[model samples]
Target: MRIALIGRPNCGKSTLFNQVAGYKAETGNFHGTTVTYTESKVRVLGEVVDLVDLPGTYVLGGSNPAEKVSHDYLGDHPVDVIINVIDATFLAQSLELTLELLRLDKPVLLAMNMMDEVARLGIKLDGPALEKELGVRIVPVVASKGRGIKALFLEAKRAAEQGILQPRFDDFQDDPYSRHKAALQLSQRFAVQGQRTLSWRDRLDDIFLHPAYGYVALAGVLLLFFQAVYGVGQLIEPPLLALFDSLITNLNTYIDTGNLLGVLLNGVLQGVMAGFAIVLPYLFPFLLGLGFLEDVGYLPRIAFLMDSLMHRIGLHGKAIVPFILGYGCNVPAIMSTRTLEDSRERFIAAALSTLVPCAARLVVVFGLVAFYLGPLYAFGLYLLNLFIIALTGRILTRLLPENTPGMILEMPPYRIPTLRAVANKAWFRIREFIVEAWPTLIFGSAALGLLVFFDIAKYFNWMVRPITWLLDLPAEVGVPLIFGVLRKELSLIMLGQALGNNDYSAVLSNAQLFTFTVFVVFFVPCVATLVMLKRELGSRQMVWVTLITIIIAMGAGLAARIFGLLL
Candidate 1:
């Protein structure tokens, strides 16, 4: 049997899905975390069942892409049971979607999640009365803590087995407003008020949502995050690189460097070394920190605080969500643009997001620029990238003028991030990068090594000599530039290999190094991001974005060269 989990955004549907499925699907206190559905199979009551976690939506008739995904999935697929999770504190508001689910005539076991919040608020809900009134089984649960989860699933299995149909009601209304009124009446009948007290969540929100101090807190938090990433990376990189170097040296003692087999082995070893030494060290800590912030509900607040600054670029503050996600990967960042209602905003966001330095690009910036020039230069590159993104956003906004809408974001109560959830999310994101990117890096490296071994690199370099001269880089840099389109990290990895060693100081001067970093930072995005841009913005817009980035990258590189000379 196939069961579907549906709920309004941040209503603990994903938390329930994680508990029931026994695998982490990314969960956040903000909307658009689950831009796509995820599926897992689990045994419930000795029966193997397929479970799907759908993207959150407020109503069946909503227009956003996430909503359309939920709506279309339900319409196209045959779901045996629907597990509609709702926030217990906001029963009436959640029931607006609940009522729409009932019209589908499917068996739905309403999981009233976040009951802990309800209890903390001193709200008393009569579960039996709600079940009876709604004509469905109501299981109160605190999904994050795993409270009442087994019982919830048991009831879900029973409902699925029994083929419970939608209850017949003479006064049932089909519209949102009518259903909202009906839900409120039901809540009043079943819910009782008790003495209220402010919890720690309420206390923290006071300072976190403060207009002035909140910005200070945000900056402090971001500072610590980057410091942790850089510090941890520094601690791990030397030992890891040394280990790989030792292994490669020992292996080379037995192999002849003049043969094809030796060439392939060297190429593979270099790629493996780059993946470990350059990418993993930094990527792991970054994702771990990002997952923690997202799970703890701080990311939305960042968006809220940045709304004022974002308006200057003609984007809603909500654009920050995708911008932050872009730091991890640009593909999903572009996909998350669906959360925005306006096509113009989405287009502008997409254009700027693709330019954000992803983990791969960061590997280049830190491993090449920072390792040689110092941390300050690497840090400057990040700031420069942001300035470019803002400038690009401003340009696009003017080119495609539209009225920007006010942001309406729900700030979820802060919760302590669980180590298990954070680890799972971090591993999931890291696994995606390793699985998709490493092979491309390895193949490109091996292919380039072969070209050099066969003495054909000079021809390739000659082909891109004009570009290298334009940027004032060496002819050897041309090979990496050509392959960088496949994967950004390949540029740095191939650069080391192309120059015959990782010691770049021997080949490129400080000015050349800075110029190269600037070019790679703003150049055309990786192939994966390009495909996503094409999908989201169509071929015409994708072409324009591609051209714009190329122009910007060349211009930036030339300007950096001139500045370096003046210095």
Candidate 2:
């Protein structure tokens, strides 16, 4: 049997899904967190059942792509049971969607999630009365805490097995206003509000959501986040690099360095070493921190704080989510742009998101710029990337010329981020980078190494000499620049291999190093990000984005070279 989990945004549906599905789905306290559906199999009542977590939608007839996913799936797919997870604290608003699910003529089990929030909010809900009125099994659950989940699924299994399709309002109209009115009437009958008092969440919101202090808090939090990533990388990278270096030295004592076997061992193993030594060190901590932010409900606050800045760039505040996610990886960042209601905004957001320095680009920035120059110079490059993104966003906005929508975001109550959830999400994201990206890096490295072994790299270098001269970089950099599109870190790793040494300062001056790093930062995204861009924004748009980024990268490199010459 196949069961579908459906609910309005931030209604704890995803939380419940992750719990029952063994943390297979990513949970966020924001709208459109799950832009696509996720499926996993679970055993309920000794029966193996397929469970799907659908994108959250406030209503069935919504226009956004994320909502359409849920709207279409429910209409087209056959499900044995529908689990409508409701936010117990907001019964009136949540029941509108609940009413829509009832009309689907499927066995529906209402999981009243966030019951702890209901108690804190002083909202008194009579579960039995509500169940009788709605004519469905109502199970009160706190999904984050795993409270009442066993009973929730047991009731769901019973509903699915019994094939109970109870439609209380047979003649109910499927319009929002009418359903809202019906939901309000129903809520009044079963839910009573006790005396309300300010909770700790409300007190924190005074500072976190403040017009003035919110921005300060955001900056402080981000500064700490980046520092933590950098600090953790510093601790792990040296030992790992030393270990790999020792292994390579020992292996080379027995194997010839001039043969094909040596080339494969040196090239492929170095690529793998670079990924673990450089990329993963920074990426792991960054992902873990991101997961904590999402679970703790701070991401939406960042979005809220970014509303005005996003507006200046002709985007809604929610666009900040993708831009922030871009720091970890651009592929999913670009995909998350689908959450925006406007197609033009989606295109502009995606284009700008591609320019945001992902972890791979960060590897080049920190590995080269910071490693040789200083942390300040490396930090300046990130600031430069943001400036470029803002400028590009302004240009794209003008070109598209559409009215940007006002931000309508729900600020979920802050909760302590669970270590298990954070670890699961971080591992999931890191696994994708390792499983999908590492092979391509290794293959590209080996292929390039073979070309060099055969003395064929000079031909490719000559082919891109004009570009090299334009950027004031040595002709030897041309090959790495070409291979950089395969993977951004490849550019840095290949640069070391191409120059025949890890000490780039020996061959290149500070000016050239700065220029090369600048170029790599703004160049076209990696193969993975490009494919994702095409998938999200269409082939035509992807072409335009690619061309635009290439132009910007060359232009930036030129400007950086001129500045270097002046210095």
Candidate 3:
């Protein structure tokens, strides 16, 4: 038997999927984490059953990729039952989505997830009445803690066996606003009895959603996030670098021998594995923190709060999703532009995503700028990217056809997302990065080794002299740029080895190093992103992204050089 788990984003659908599917497949707190549907098989009651986790969506009709996946599956795929997970804390808004599912004329069992928080808020759910009214089984569950999950699955499995569970009430039409109102009134009557108690969460929301303080808080949050990334990298990088050095020493002395062994150890293994040590330790921890914040449902609030500013740039608030994803890796972020509706919006979003200093870029920036200029310069680079993104977004908005839609987003109530869930999600994304970029990184190292072997690097360095001259960088920085086109992290790794120190002062001036780092920041994304851009937005847009980025990087580097001279 086949069963599908569906719900609006951040409604614990993926959490329940992890629970039932017995592994982390599609789980996150952010929008569009599960852009594609994931299918798995599980054993229940000694019988193996197929389970599919569909992407979360407010409605099946929405144009976003996640919504399309869910909508298409409902229309075509034959599912014995639907497990509609809803956030118990945000019942009014979540139930509106539930109403839409009810209208789909399929068997749905409502799993009122996060019930622990609901009960703590002193909210009483009339589960039997709600089930009777909806003509479906209502199973109150806390997906994170595994509370009431067994009952939910038991009911879900029974529903699957018995066929459809249709709703009793069919009074409301399918309009978003109408269903929103109806769901609200229904919740007001059944969920929140008497006066809804003033919980700490409500008070916190008031502070966070405040117009003046909220914006300040958001800025502070972003600033701290970048600073934390730098601070954490400092705490970890030295020891890890030393460890790799020791390992490389032992491997060269004892392990490496024959031509094949020598090539694999010194050229392929040492270079690529060294690259992973430099990048992943910093990238994974930072990404894990971001993933925690995402799973806690803060990213959508950021999108909502930034919507007005985003609209000025031809993007809805939802663009923040792709932008945050960009920090992890640009390839997925570029593909994620499908969440944005308009063609112009996707183009603008894709371009901005490329500018966002991804984790790999951050590794480069931290290693180069932080070592050369200071941590302050590294922090400034992040802010500089943000400023450029916002400014360029506005420019592209005005330059384009002006059909970008405003952001209509849902702000899920804050909850303590499970560590396992967050780790699983962070792992999935980081794993994708390792799998896709690591091979290219290894090949880049081998190619560089070959270049050095043939003494071609010297001539190639001379060939790119014009670019180095314009950017106020040494000819040697060009080597990293060559490897950088393949993988951004390699730029820093190459720079470290070339400089023969983590400090990087031997190869270039402080001003020149900072300029070069900024240039790398705005440089064209790695080949992975370029390929994805071609696939997502077509070859024309891909060419435009490449040309625009090169121009921007050069301009920024020149400006930085002039500013340094004045300083």
Candidate 4:
């Protein structure tokens, strides 16, 4: 049996998925679609069944990959039943989406989640009445607490065997406005409002979502977040790197360091050191903090805070999701452009999203600027990054004009983050680096070492000399810049090989370090991101984006060099 899970974001869809997703659960792109969904094999009703979790979206009919997946899967796949997860706190909007599912004429088991929060809000929902009204089974569940999940799946299994039930109300029509009104009427009739007591969660939003204090608080939160990452990275990185350097010096005693075999061996070692010492030190803690913020439901509030500012770039607040994801990795950030309805907005969001300083670029900034200079210098680089991104957005928007609609989002209530969930999320990302990126870094580092030993690297250095000259950086940096396009971490790792020194501060001045880091941060994204841009946009736009990035990097690097000189 195949049972699908569907719901809007912040409705506990992910919580429920985690509850039931066995180790077999994995996320992948749907066949013939670019966006992804998760599927798992689970035993339900004494039989192993396929449980699929679709992407979270507010409306299924909207113009996004979610719509295409919904229409394609529901229309063709053997989807026996759908478990529509609903947030009881936002019944009106949740039910409005349920109405969309009913139009499919498929069996739906309504899972009303977050009942605990509902009760605390003093909102009463008549389960039986709503079930009767909608002609579906309604199961009250608190997914995070593991309440009612067993019975919920049991009902889902039963519904799959029973087949489809016709929607009870004829008020459901083709029009969206009609569906909205009907959902509102049904919630009013079935739910009763009680004496509400204000809680800390309510007041928390008042501060987090406040106009004046919110930005101040955001700055404070970010400052602490970066400090924590830098602190942990600082303490661990020095001892580890020193150990590796000592081992390399000892290895030189066994054989000549200039020989071909010795150079290749050392190159591979540097790659491993880069991933373990320089990258993971900063990457893990950054991801941990990001996951905590995400689980605590603070990310969307940032979008709300930045919505007005986002409009200055020809995008809506919803477009900020890609930017947030970009900080983690640019591949997923590009993938997230599907959530934006307008093509122009998607392009603009994707373009700016790449500039958000991903974890790879994060390592570069933290390793060189933050580590050698200070956190304040690294912080200055980030400020410069955002300013450049905003300036680029302003330019792009003027070229392709559009008026984006204001954001309408359901704010999930703040909940204490679970260690298991946050850690697992961070682990998944770190594991991806271990499995996919680490190998590339090791092999690329080795290849770069061979090129430098053979004197062929000078050609690559020659190719990028114009940009290096313009930025007032060392000519040898051109080779690392060329190879860095394959993987951003290579920019720094190979720089050590090209200059014949592992210690950057000993070789390069403060101005050179500042300028080079700026260039790497804004230069062409990694090959993965480039492929994703091509997949998302088109070949033509991909070329345009790549070219535009090279130009931007040159401009930003030169600007940083001039600033360094003036200071």
Model 2 lDDT, residue 309, Cα: 89
Task: Report how far residue 519 has shifted in candidate 3, in Å.
Answer: 1.8
Q: Which sequence of candidate numbers ranks them by TM-score, best first?
A: 2, 1, 4, 3
Candidate 4 residue lDDT tens string, 53-135: 77666677656765566556666778889999998888988988898888777788899998988899899989998888888
**Residue-pair clash count for candidate 2:** 0
Tens digits of per-residue lDDT for model 1, 117-182: 888788899988777777888898988888998898888888888986656332567887898888
lDDT of 2 by residue, 385-470 (tens): 88888888888788887777677877788887778889989998888888878888888788878988999999999998988988
Q: List the residue pairs that clash in candidate 2.
A: none
Off by over 4 Å in 2: 165-172
After superposing candidate 3, which stretches have Cα over 4 Å from the reference?
22-33, 90-106, 165-194, 246-264, 458-463, 496-503, 564-567
Q: Report the error of model 1 at residue 170, Å.
A: 5.5
Instruction: Rate residue 165 of model 4 by lDDT.
Output: 54
- Which residue pairs collide in model 1, if any? none
- How does candidate 1 fare on TM-score? 0.96
TM-scores vs. true structure, each candidate? 0.96, 0.96, 0.88, 0.92
